[model samples]
Target: MYSKFIINKDSFLGLAMNDIDKSSGNSLTTKYKNIVDSVLKEKFENNKYIDGSKIQSEWFPQVKCDIFLSHSHKDVKKAKQFAGWLKNKFGLEVFIDYNIWGNINDLLQNIDDTYCYDKLKGTYSYKKRNFTTSHVHMMLINALADMMDRTECLMFFETPNSIDLKKMTHSTESLTESPWIYNELFLSKILQNIQRRKKNELVKSQESVRLYADLNENFNPKYNVDISHLIDLSNDDLKNWLFHYKDNKHQNKPHSLDVLYNLKNINLK
Candidate 1:
């Protein structure tokens, strides 16, 4: 169970940023390299049926993450900056899927070249390609679901790249071209809602303060997304949450999320 926070462009950009350098790009690239290496190793290591359990374990290792950041592929830079801010101020470890998932195409290409490519045709077999894609996508979806289940919070960076504002004759709606973003948003809304686990009950040892799109090609399909269920989070709420966390001393150790949940929603009517 996790809480979803919707932070629009304005609210996100307004937050006071720490002096985090642009080194996130290098680190993100290196992290992605490691994942690609691991994937290649798993494929070449031994000849055994790659079962669901092995795929889950090999493809998605248990990373310590307090917030699962959901956003467009284009917003990776902004997401990294935001992640740095969260870490600097709150000691939160964020798992940005872009660090790995953004390079999914490369992974797919490697796999296809090895197994799905037809040498004579100089192209991949349509059916074989589909089979490989479905398996990889299924693994990705399952990993995402498992990560969301383990994390305490999810923050979606709302931006033009991630969502399109559609105005009909009588109503307005938010639509996303990327099925991945749509899936993340849909899961965030429906995933089990539970309170943050206490420190003693947590499997991972608490480090510190507990916590915590893109465009298109030709055949893009738009998904109608509803973000009303997500709690609206603003810059003011972030500042206030910091204060609330600093002041709370009644409990042995307060959950950082409790302070956020207790705050009034300024965006809700």
Candidate 2:
């Protein structure tokens, strides 16, 4: 099962993790890009009907992670800093979408230029681009959901960039301008909270679930987000968790996050 945490603005500020993070990020991004590129090339090698559904599994394969950081595109730098801080302080692997899937735009552009372009008119076909984008976005949404399901914790970096203060008149109601953020938050609220399986336990694979049937090329709908269920953690709460972690640093590094769960008495499994 996943535990959701909302990190308020200015909760923590520190230098990002050093070259280690940079190097690892570069390696992972390059590897992912290569894999995606190869998969696309292999699919197009023949003119036979291409099954986009089958390729979704090959694109953006899931990776083991400790925390999933969901934030606005504008807050990417802050998310990176927070991720680095988490890595340095707790040895946690933070999954920031851009870091791993930054080449999404490149992939879209490539598809549009190759299949959606009208060479005679020197322009891209709107309908063709729409079809390509829908498929790419669907694949990304599925991959993201899988990652969220696998991670132990999901943290949303809440700030003005991600949350619309004007619409938040009541404690229960929240709004966001981002469709991606809306989808992520919506999934967090509904996705089943499965208990973390032990190392030796055999995992069960379930059928893929698609919840965004209304998504489209012009996906600009306003979202009334429900974040009341997410546990609110301020700077002090993070500091308290950090203090507890340091006090018993000798515990297993991988399961160090259990300290925060125990502190909040939340069943994260």
Maximum-lDDT candidate: 2
lDDT of 2: 0.68
| Model 2, residue pairs in steric clash | 1-194, 195-269
* Residues 1-269, model 1: lDDT tens digits: 45788888888555666456235433544564476457645743442334554663534453656788888989878788777777666666677767557666776677677778889989888788777767766666665666666778889888899988754545535888778877778777667665445332323221111100222255567788877777778878888887777787786756566667668532211
Model 1, residue 249: distance off in Å is 7.6
Error of 2 at 3 (Å): 0.3
lDDT string for model 2 (67-150, tens) is 888998898766666776677777877777664355667767777778888999999888887787777676667666766766
Which 10 consecutive positions of candidate 2 have the poorest summed lDDT? 199-208
Q: Candidate 1 at residue 227, lDDT?
A: 79
Q: Give per-model TM-scores.
A: 0.78, 0.78
**lDDT of candidates 1 onward, in order:** 0.66, 0.68
Candidate 1's displacement at residue 239, Å, is: 1.9
